[model samples]
Target: MSYTKTQTNPTPFPLVKVGMGHLKIATAGSVDDGKSTLIGRLLYDTKSLTTDKLKAIEEKSKQRGFDYLDFSLATDGLIAEREQGITIDVAHIYFSTPAKSFIIADSPGHVEYTRNMVTGASNAQASIILVDARNGVIEQTYRHFFINNLLRIKEVIVAVNKMDLVNFSEEKFQTIKNEINYLATKSDFEAQKITFIPISALNGDNVVEKSTKMSWYQGETLLDYLENIDTTLTNDSANARFPIQTVIRPKTAEYHDFRAYAGKIYGGDFSVGDPVLVLPSLTKSTIKNIYFFDQEFDTALSGSSVSITLTNDVNVSRGDMIVKIDEIPTIAKELEATICWMDKEPLQNAQKYYLKHGVNDVQAKITHLSTILKTDFSGVEENTTALTLNQIGDIQIKVSKPLFFDTYKKHKYNGAFILINPKTNNTVGVGFIKSPL
Candidate 1:
């Protein structure tokens, strides 16, 4: 997408602030789906590509005997990727306009790299799923969309790419759109807000600006939509959850008797004098002060890393949670969750593993394996005894101690956990809490 010098926005977009101005987006699709090319196009159009990098892409494209500059050369950073012509790891491409900065996660497309796709895009606020206009909506397309749905991404831009290959046929674009819409109805999950756009990333059509070849598309360009999309709200809950990471106490004689609980606040906001409850002990207290370094503030919102001091001398320790009295989460030892197996070893019944939930680590045992969820988001397969690599399933887990958590549907951060193999110490699977069992 190239913005010619002539065409410019009269009412410019807002300038990005230091902390809140940028957006994180993840791109996913099957091999040869133009994920890298789309990213390269965005970088090029926005003038984010350095001269050396652009020269490198040009040289690489020439070496491959290509007539046009292959934008995919910009993102295939790994030697293996260049040799195999497939993405193996998540390549983060950074670009910025005057209005905002964007971080695009170019995730792997192969079936075996599904774990990388999940971990790379888990924190992204939005996603772009590339569909080959020739292939339309294939299995990998369904898998990519299904994973995006599982991640609870609020906004999805389905780019129907390679329109030039199909002679810019509106009929082909509409057919792909209909198939996707029909496939969306097969799942019970609430499909996210989907916006379809037709583009030819190679020729820079409908990327940064409208394509003259296809005047049929009436929607905004990809960059325009991203600039205007609402990313303020996410999948995380609105209630505040402050999990104590550590305690800070001053031993110096300058002005002794200083103690603060330091942790990053998730969700909601906390203000001085707010009624708060300490977890496990269930002690009641009021917030006395909130501090960032030497400065003190009246309140701190979600995503703030500040030290908090309570009114009374409360016995709070690491791994304990502090939340609003009325916003206390469920405390339990057993939970039902959707599990994504990431390791080569299969997850079996009664398998012992170490579970890591936020700042706390505890022993966990898989009590039962439920059903294998098809990647296509079709129903489930019963009598599934093991969850293999790259498979999504449901299971029951019993932790060593009661955990203060919420369902993943309600609180994303508090509701997810990782299972580490005790023997290998490798992260074997990630679980999204469904409910307390």
Candidate 2:
């Protein structure tokens, strides 16, 4: 495949430019789809791998009696994974170019490890769905595709891997692309942008470098597309939300008067004097000052950790959110959610547990069992009494106190929460809250 910067969105601050920014992506596919090899190729080609790591990889390949350097040896971390020649967990790899920094989560491809893939892809802005060029598509491919859509990943790169095994035939690549398109059309996603690339992870063709044999293909290499992607296209830069983590009061000689609310901005922008409301109490306040680290700032953007002082000290404390008054999310005691059962035991009705929403944790009970989702098809089995491990289901829960939340589709940070077993302190379920109820 070769990529140039297609578009660049201008930002007032030179450092905040879109196309020339870091991007986080997750990679998924069925078993033995070469995800690890692809990641190693990216690190090696970009010269981001340290000399020692590269040398260790070469030595390991030789130890295994391989003629060519086995790139998968670089990321297959677990002993069982190395022995089985499969990725059994998520391995986070970091690399960067002059254009942008990259974090790739190489997730396990086996059916049993679907939860691991979900954990890795939850925070990703883009995802790569790999398909073996020889095998085309299968049922696991449908499951992966469904999860990608469910997570609302904006960009999907359908990498048809191991093209060298198929003689780098353009027909094979086209067939895989067509199959993916058909599968995508059947999904309930927002019609994400899908790019088809033919590559051999083992041979490193069309990965970081253009393939010479594929003269018929005239497109950007995988790395090129990744590096030049307009990251602003996938960002939610509109809504302003800041969940207060701690009330900062540095009791010092010079900073005795400082009473700042410290927290990371979940979404949106904050100006010097924007009208904001403190949630869980609904007390109104206005920003008096915004301080990032030790420096006093006039504004703070999303993902930036900062502290703010309110005009009225209306008893705001830890776990309280300061958001635009008109844009405050719904506060309710009862909630409907889509949950992924994470425990070995099934989720039973009338069971009381702890619900951890953002920084605020509360006790909750399962009031009703709505439905269990069937992964193969986008349908539900209603009136389910309990949810087993790896099962996705609709549930109604009532909490001891009201929670400030948004629908999962609207605001991911607020929409998502986790269920914990109070007795064991283990996370048993991951859930996305349903809105307007």
Candidate 3:
């Protein structure tokens, strides 16, 4: 078999835009299941890697006494990861095609690195869960899938890798696909779109190019699917939410009265003449002007970081949320959230921590541990006592101040928070707001 290097240009496909800026993907699988190799294969096949990178892979593969190029080297950048042949941290990779730009978060698959996986998948719009054909679906596979479901990732690609080891057996691929399909029926995210493909990351079959060995398979390659997948967020449909990051004031002789609230739009768009409400203070104001740097825009869409001058100065400051007057979020001192515990210390009731919701921070305490969720998507263990490291559970929390937020399902950016250990100043947990409690 000959390994021919291809140029880094994507083949033309039907142009499709989902109104999203860039696509973010998280990859997960069991150890030695070729998760890193699959990513490496994608980069290699896409011609995203530089000449030095290809040379490095060739030298490393020869040094390791491997006949084929070790594509895993392309993503496993850490010295410990390269030495141990296991990914320990999340490695972010950026590459673009003619159709779209992509950011892949290569997450660790070890059982202990479940926290790491959550960190990667939290911001991802899609997920790629790899399953070794020889091993089929295992415990780790269930955990990864559960995380994707919990995050509400709408799209998933289940790549049954190492087809070469299975002699390109169609039966083996079908069995694995059937297993995942059955698992999906039990998942909370029943509407998730899952695509299964047989691939050999080592030999680059069905990753970027069609696999001649599996002639019965008539689906697009993994690259084809990702390039055309719709990754648009639902922010367009949600209410406008802009958490004030800072107050922009130019104390100059010429523009001494310029005071504007600066932040990124987290939800729907905002227009110049829109009626806005300042949260907590409940101050009413009208947008006088929207400025993106020196240029002014009539309207600002979600995710755009800009400054807005209000018609009246109602004492707005940092941590204040400016939202549409008609579509106000729940403002409450107590909240119910699904939290993924990340610290080594178990999450106990009455434990105080600093909760950061967007740019706002407030003192919070866990009031109740409702239930400990099982990661296998089987069922929930109700009335759980505590959540240990890497365990996810539902809890009620009391905050020092009222928080203006939406449900995570409704608005992702406005619904997420991080619990900081006040004493140690470390981030201990991540929470997704369910509703005001």
Give the best candidate by TM-score: 1
* Global lDDT scores for all candidate models: 0.87, 0.82, 0.87
Worst ten in a row by lDDT for model 1: 5-14
In what order do the candidates fall by TM-score, top score first? 1, 3, 2
Residue 138 of model 2, lDDT score: 77
- Point out the higher-scoring one by lDDT: 1 or 2: 1
Q: Candidate 2, after superposition: displacement of residue 212 in Å?
A: 2.2
lDDT order of candidates, top first: 3, 1, 2
lDDT of 2 by residue, 307-366 (tens): 898888778888888899888888999989988887887899999999998888889999
Candidate 2, residue 266: lDDT: 76
Compare candidates 1 and 3 on TM-score and give the better one. Answer: 1
Looking at model 2, residue 46 earns an lDDT score of 66
Candidate 2 versus the native: TM-score?
A: 0.92
* Model 3: per-residue Cα lDDT over 180-292, one tens digit each: 89998887665688999999998889888888899989998888888777656412257889999999888999789989999999778999989989998999999989999
